[model samples]
Target chain A: MIGSWMTLPLVLVAAPPPPLDPDPRASPPAAAVEADPKAEVPPLPLRDARRAEQAPPPDVMRAADNPRVPKAKPGPPFYDAADEAVFRARFDLTKDPAPPPRTVRMRCLVADPLCGITVEVQALSAYALRAQQGSVATANARTWHSARAQYDVWVQFPAVVRTIGRTRFNVLSMGPKGGIVASDGGDLWANVGLAMRAFFGKGAFAPHLEVTGALAFRIGGFTEGGAGFFGAGRTDLGPVRSPVGFAMDIGVGLGGFGSLVIGGQYDSPLAREEVPESLRTPAAGMFYVGFRGNILWGAPAAAAVTTHVLAGRLVVPER
Target chain B: MRAGVRPLRGRAGVGYRVHAVVILPLASVLLVASLASPAAGSEAEAPPRTNRYLEAPPSSAPAGEDFGPFFTGPPASETSFVKAPRRGSGLAPRLSVRDGLFCFVEDAHCVASLLASTDVGIGMAIIGENGPDLPYAQLTFRGGFSLRPVTLYRKRYHPWALGLTASYSVGTGGIRLQAEDVVETARTQATRIALVNQLWLWHRPHAFHLDASIGAVRSGVLGRDERIHDLWGTHVELALGFGGWASLVVSGDFLDEDTRIVFGFRTHALAGVPVAGLTALGLWAGGVL
Candidate 1:
């Protein structure tokens, strides 16, 4: 028991000091012990172990500080914080928390060919970076710098190609109840035409209009050589271009696919001398209705539809 | 009075003949040739206009890198261990079924689906005739088939396409009265049949089409007299399909003294095909322009 008591004092004296707090966030002890002014400084953790290991010995450190001592090639290790600071200054490594230099591409709004600008944006957030890029693409899309010529086609209905008119064109010539005129010189006539179309709307259904002009070929009524309605067999009165024919249509456009339309047409009276004054009747008017459909080219709706069909998406999917 | 009228009639007849034989034909030929010249020219002569929306997205690859190196096989030493006999027959038919039948959707300007590129459609128009009574209207049914032949200055745009078109028109009633209508009477119906060969020109197939055709017509079906006549025709067609599926046609048909105008529509030949439809859309958008 006497010997144990004697050794306890020695053991107490030999015990090592407790380790400093590993976490910097921990508060210091309230009753902090004042550090000795002349005591050797405690070594710091290896924040930069490489530079620490390369630290010169005391004598070399002192020699490095003294310019009088001729230094070897590549010089000596940094002797103090000031020396390290000076070295870092030369290499520009002292700047702390340094992030990579941010960069962005910019362009002029006036469509200048040499307007591309590389901007060194500093400290932009992730969201900001994306916004920058997206805006650039938008600008590019809106800019006319790379604008190319564009052309689009207009399709109209009842596109008129030719026209002719004859007062008795269809009345006395080619009617269903026409056997009354037996003479070969009786009134008979024919007219031909072509048309065009137009549209003014969007989507699968829209309003449309069509105008047509007739291409008149055979237009005069047959001349009656004999007297009455029961004269000789019918004879052609020959072709004439006196009257005019026209047709118009208005209805809904079927999304460039075709049209659901209602239309009417008219052929004017023949004003030619071929027909006798008695046989010359007023212009024959005819009206008919039907549905016509057509395809559209270079239409935005076409592109959207194609994308949807092929990829099952209205827009091209991002990779 | 008769002598005075005779001289006037003679002058009028001479003028009409001159106009028909010279001025009219000359004008028609000039109009068609002028419209078709651009399509006949080489693509290089008139490069397609660029479209901003069609530009390719910007690439992020590094500059000056040789892509060839990436595609090349590894060193011979590494490949030596994998040596094996070639499996496929060395001689294979040059044209594959896929090449003839299919097309890539992204490539709008390619003519890869030639085998299925023939256009066929049916059309209708109103016909007018001077019958025994007031002017009457009749319905005309038309069926057409067309094929594009190879052109000298061909490129992706295919602005100019020389085509052979065969068409048949069935006219009922009117000027050519229906045989049934004339059966009760002493008269016979004069039905007409016509065929056409067309030359097509445009920036894109779906954009515009200017065609001039010459064919033959035969008239007087079920009639006492059957007459055959030479024919000529012209057409201005525009494709208004947003989907590039159909086109509107304005056509003129002339058979001797008879002339007719018709408005019609034609659906794209390959519209029903799987990938070719996309190609049609591309071509309509001025492929690669």
Candidate 2:
């Protein structure tokens, strides 16, 4: 008993001093602490820790000195200290919650965006001193797509020689029942067309050909006046201005006419661009073999017709 | 086996002219008789205008361009993939098939399937005789309409299409099909309704198109022991052609657990009309009127 009493005094003196309260709400009044200037003050846990590890303290005023922030002015104590009791009582007693979620900034490299693509640069959250960059990969994942801009340069390549010119065309005139018709020589008809084709794989694709099937359209019977109540009289038509629709099909050592172009074209009735009220019969589904080389270039020839009427085949209405 | 797939496609022979001779007269007579009826009547009054120069030239339009319009502008130098819209319309021969044999769905006996011609006309296909499995079946005949009414494309190179077909086939043979539990045997006629989705890859230089379609097929038999088989079928086709208006087609079809392939060649300017189409199956020829 005598020895225990002797060591108790020494053990109590060696123990560490109790830590100060870190929470502002748990702190005593400033006046009360001011009276004891020598008392050690508690350090703000989250605010000080994050600041020390991350960046320099913000340049803007802190919550304590900011004019915009509410001060502890004695009267009415901010919340009728009477009615807001429960709401205020439930508030957390921690210093500065988690750091604010990162704010992002986006920038582009070019203004006009040439070479066929638009590029964007963004700056994510980072630590200045440590020079650590935040992740941006997830957000940029969905930026690529089929509609994205593209650039291509054609390079000359040697390709095998192959025969060109082998398209079939049906040029026929139908009377009321699709028989041979000779009305005023069956309304003399002529067709001239031109097309510009961008060949892809060199030789064969040098001029892309457009292929179409029958009038897969069921317009509810526009020509039902035919024999036995036949439905559609016109064959299904594709575009009249296929990239390579009209070629220089000059008959050299062949049996075909000098000008052979079998494609869909519209003259009037189906015109979608010009004056809407113009209801002329659309010259569609006719297989025409133009022997005249009156028109040499294709673009002007195509523009000549397309400008007047719709390209007979299948085309979307103008926006 | 849809009507618009491939019906009569195979290794073509040198009988290109012979094929045309047989179908020409038949088509002419039929067309003449049909024309004897009356001019087709339309609800609208305006006549179809075939003249592109009907209107006087505008100051800027590229009309009266008699010589050469070659070497155009910006569109020429810049190269990009083609992007086509949905809902495209096109016409083909009356009796064309993309793939999946019509007769193969039931017998795969006497005849092979016909490939749908890219041309616009009417056609027929008939194959005589069959294997021992369908001894009674003397021949098979099928005909119908095939159309590609809806088409979508990502680029000119990647084309997608939806095909609608309605066709009828008659096989004069005993339906010798032994299912898991039931056995069916009898002579009957079959009708097929099919919708197929197609993917077309274009080989620009050769003017070649490689296409494939897959979809649902319903083969319905009309007879005493009528039955229907619902299944999926696929068809693949390779077409080669020169620019302008002529092409050779070879296609393969797999339907009703059987495979059939056919070949054909089409010429545009021939025998009076602007277009002439000939098929190897029934040796039929039809042209646009």
Best by lDDT: 1
Writing each residue's lDDT as its tens digit, candidate 2 over B137-232 gives 111111222222321111111123344433222222122222222222221223333443433332121122333333332332212233333334
lDDT of 1 by residue, B46-160 (tens): 3232322112122221111111211111111111101011111101111112211112110112233221111211122223342233222222222232332332122212223
How many clashes does each candidate structure show, in the order listed? Answer: 59, 67
Q: Candidate 1: TM-score?
A: 0.26
lDDT of 1 by residue, A55-152 (tens): 44221112223243443343243143355556568887643323212211111111111111101100000000000111223552111111101011
lDDT of 1 at A8: 24
CAPRI quality of model 2 = incorrect
Give the best candidate by TM-score. Answer: 1
- In the range A1-319, model 2's lDDT, one tens digit per residue, is 1232233232122212234246544656588688885655565677555654564322212223333334444334333333234443567423322331221111101111011111111000100110111223443211111000000011111121222111111111110000000001011111122122112222111222222122111111111112111111232211111001111221111111012233222222323332122121232222222211111222322322222122112122111
